[model samples]
Target: MSGPIPVADYMRLALAQTPQVSDQNKTEINTNEQGYYMKQDVFGQGGDFITSPEITQMFGELLGAWGIQCWKQLRGPSKFNVVELGPGRGTLSRDMLKVFSKFQNVVGNDISLNLVEISPFLSQKQHEVICIPSEKLEQDQKNLSPPSNSYQQGFSKDNGCPVSWYKDIRDVPKEFSLYVAHEFFDALPVHKLQKVDEGWREVLVDIKPDNEKEFRFVISRHETPMLNVLRTRYPKLFETSRNHLEISLDALLILEELTTRLEECGGIAVIIDYGHDGTKEDTFRAFRKHQLHDPLTDPGSADITADVDFSIIKEIFSDKALVCGPVSQQTFLRRLGIDLRLDNLLKAAKTEVEQDQLRSGYKMIVNDMGTRFHCISLFPKVLEKYLGRLKFAGFHE
Candidate 1:
């Protein structure tokens, strides 16, 4: 008779027919869907998309240099934490650790590496990569062994540093920490809202009755508590008639905890992602096989993301931390000496093919297309003395 319903259609039906489904529920449905990340290789080759770290070694190397500078500005803390949120495959940390290993005398050897990652598959991949020595990292890059099915879960060691995985940032111990979150916030769930005649209503997902299997966006009938809070706190967002808005409460909550930690313990955090500084626009999107796809087409087969609003982050941490430029990624990396690093690598290149690859990767991350990605740094206000009047490379003119 009739063929079985598609997974996407079945999911939409289940969610829509439920007693109550909020915007948050839709986000959870998409993000935590079974076989989403595991079935579809979402990072690097054979995956839906790739990130900057995947594009070039220079990307991670420059970030490593920035970390070293920050460490020095903090007066060379004897024991500090290097934390990375959503460290995909640990490529960035591995590169940074290589740099730290080189300057062990100056940066000290008492550093602990903390990676906050949720995907079991990604965690295993990170563990394998993080344990590889930098000298051999390039050689072993192509032959990455699939993660063992029976791999142990939890803390492990990489070089001299103790590597630990946590489900949430709250699990990380309270310590003077250097934090980096590259392309992390965009994946977090966002609640979409639209201005209404009365006030504002949340956008929800529902199954089309005639189609029965297809899904469509429907605005809520009444205002939600989140809508009321948004109207009161960010009246400017609602100034335009029928303007659509998106907010990531999860991102703000994490920022609140991070700021509190930075205030209590001296440290700096670097956030780099693609988004506008303060401008508002609907940016909900999906990626499958490196191409844009309809977000509602597949429940768990595609990657869902949205542009981050850096202005909100700056506002949240302004009181407790010195917020630096949300400058273009091009400017930030160049100021941090990416060009010099690339030149040095070029000189070391043994083959013309290798040299060409390096140049291509460099352009992919530092060219006009990549400049849309922004970098922001936050330093605790209490550490101003130790940080002195030091002009951070990326943020300073």
Candidate 2:
């Protein structure tokens, strides 16, 4: 707590200070491993950046249709759940189920709707999404001000799902039919390391008082025992990767669980994040209030994240599932039916300028947002055999 603590000790203190971080509990993750600082850092003006769903209802609307369709394909699994991982503001989930308010099933209890998240603030915001507590997310949502009763009210089953916030992934409700993870993986902790002509090196954040007060990145040797465990498990990362490359062991492990869920359990997993595919260079970033900043400069104020590597996910799953293109948010939504939805909204009411603004925002989501953000879907390998004569039947099968 005083001066010049070794990286290991600093890390130990960090783990102690970190609340609601399951990954931090791992002994191996706390030491030399880099990244992974999951906590109550999302939302409001001071917190990290906002997501797509927070930007527009269109994003959530399409995802909703996708979830419902998945439910239909799963024989409308009577007891299944429409689950969302890290449902920020719960906007996506709320907007999605808006169209499913009246869905009826003759099951004993009906479907379970669930959201998995850690932040209590965001948790409450989700109630607004479900029209439960009926509150706006940002106090500002109240200012833009829609009519008091304009919020859509849908009929949902009383046997609703609980908002599970357990730290461990094992604690998530098992056997969920459709799971949505939007802009989630990019925020998960990633391991940062650089390779030299000789071998690899681990990166560490060191505190320094020599310059009055500050912390900085200090490169260390790769042969450390901590690194050996990671490299042993993921040699292909080193193979496809080049010198000075950054690897997201976090992403890889998430993929392992994702594939396992799709294979063992029946459902599709959608991942929307910012990144590119390649055995290329590193991609780590820090953001504060919608602006990118130097992670090294600030200890915890800046939101640190990295490029999501969706390219290697197929390789990780092999022939286990159907992996779709990491298409633009614009193209994917257009295919899933955003234009038609907007058209109906325009036809129904509102002024021409309001409708035009919606159209422009839609374009920004693509040429501006979707171009940077990407979406991918993984359908279980066995699903092809099960899907009837649907459009994706032959292709997925």
Candidate 3:
């Protein structure tokens, strides 16, 4: 309902208004103007939105199963760590370890549980979930119900790896392998661009004057080198018919760094998030409370995300890593044995209500996340022979 503002003035206004980038405030309106992640407001039943980990124990369990498969491929390293990025409520980590423990010792002094969380709020919550004292862990082990014959028969001989918590990926042992990032990539900041009469212009956020209380997006044409970089680095993307392209430099940088880190370390990193396949649209959008809202609605408050341009990613990393998925989460889970896991789970349920909830969770992953939510996986240094030098189908150069 307001007049459109040019992106240049918008960026200038936002930057001039930027409170701070680091240090104490913890509020992102201060830091994120410079491209940093704002702290998440994660909590009990009333947060921004619930993640897959919060949805069902099954998601974490399946990921745990997948991790175990990767670990087996790693020859069962006895001393590696289990790491999760942006651990919210620590549910996924807990669920992951639960499955990991079924195959290997979990609540032991040696295994380290490493959580890489930036928000103090989420980190404290994660600490409560994962860092149970050694004494209590021992007691819980004794109190734990005896494993079913299937678990005992399938994973009885496996040894549990130690756990370690890190605030940054650099802190994770370069040698320690298997990694999981569930819904992590989407939260990263992506640059929005719109081609113009003159040239390509970058989209930026600026505070509106009507009351300076809220922020809105504005596009400013670039007369400098960023335009060059955008044109050169993303030619195919720019050439596409989209009105704008939301570029995830963070995703690219993260993949690049992960490839370098795991090149010598040897591990598999699995990424599951709500996204799309090709590098084709401006999918920048936001969710407030639970429903979708205009992306310009709220800057720091709403959960903002964009559909992933995974084809661009393939172009970037086809040489170093074996990237799979970008497949449906439903499809990936099915291939990874989620159907078998759920059938056993539903049959084991003693009550109707419990069976219904389990069935609902299973449907959430397969039906909703299956088609709409994409899964992109990375097998660094592990799947070279299987994927190496292949033509890399699904995209044309």
Candidate number achieving the greatest TM-score relative to the actual structure: 1
**Of the candidates numbered 1 and 2, which has the greater lDDT value?**
1
Error of 1 at 102 (Å): 1.2
Residue 5 error, candidate 1, Å: 21
Q: In candidate 1, what residue range of length 10 has the lowest lDDT sum?
A: 1-10
In candidate 3, stretches whose alpha carbon ends up further than 4 angstroms from where it belongs are 1-45, 74-76, 105-111, 133-163, 208-214, 224-243, 386-397
In terms of lDDT, model 2 sits at 0.59
**Clash totals in order:** 0, 1, 15
Residue range 1-397, candidate 1, lDDT tens digits:
1212222233333222212223332223333335454433478877888888988888888888788888786674688678899898788888888777778777776877888876777877887887643344454442544223322223223445667778788878788889999999887767787777876678866655456555667777887676677677656556554377667777877888888888888787999998877675688887888899887665566777788888777765677788888999998888888889889999999999999999999998999446679999998877556555688878886
What is the overall TM-score of model 3 with all chains considered together?
0.76
- Tens-digit per-residue lDDT, 280-321, candidate 3: 566767676777866554344556677777777666676787
Please report the candidate that would top lDDT against the real structure: 1
- Lowest lDDT 10-residue stretch of candidate 3: 148-157
287-391 per-residue lDDT for model 2 (tens digits): 877888775553444566677776767555656777766776667777777778778877875788878877776776756887787777887776666545554
Return the number of clashes found in candidate 2.
1
> How big is the positional error of residue 80 in model 3, measured in Å on the Cα after superposition?
3.1
